[model samples]
Target: MSNVTTYKVTGMSCGHCEGAVSSELSEIEGVSAVQAAADTGLVTVTFTEEPDDEAVRAAVDEAGYELVGRA
Candidate 1:
């Protein structure tokens, strides 16, 4: 089964920021899909398995954004 999670991110101000975050998250081993919205500062990730939330947060942090919360 697929495991999907949505995170509320902050400090994304442009499409470049979204693209960076998307690229980072997409490179993760189990990540199947990633959608990052600059306008809403939301990131939705779909994984082949239950991916580590910390990894996701780390990816965002590496991309120069902040993961505020998850749902």
Candidate 2:
């Protein structure tokens, strides 16, 4: 089944930041779509399965942002 998950991401200040976060998250195996908003610090992800929290966190970190847990 498909699921939508939202995570709190910090340090995004522009559209480029949003793209950076989204791009990194998209690399995850089951992720289908990523919507990141710089203004709200929310990154919404659509996937086929519940992704591991640590994996998500690492991707966020790799994108130079902070994942403040699920939203």
Whose TM-score is greatest here?
Answer: 2
Q: Give the TM-score of candidate 1.
A: 0.91
lDDT of each: 0.90, 0.96
Candidate 1's residue-wise lDDT over 1-71, tens digit each?
78788999999999899999999999899899999999988899999976688888899999999989795
Best by lDDT: 2
Tens digit of per-residue lDDT, candidate 2, span 1-71: 78999999999999999999999999999999999999999999999977899999999999999999999
TM-score of 2: 0.97
Whole-model lDDT, candidate 1?
Answer: 0.90
Alpha-carbon runs more than 4 Å astray in model 1 = none
- Which portions of model 2 show Cα errors greater than 4 Å? none
Query: What would the TM-scores of all predictions be?
Result: 0.91, 0.97
Superposed on all Cα atoms, model 2 deviates from the true structure by an RMSD in Å of: 0.6
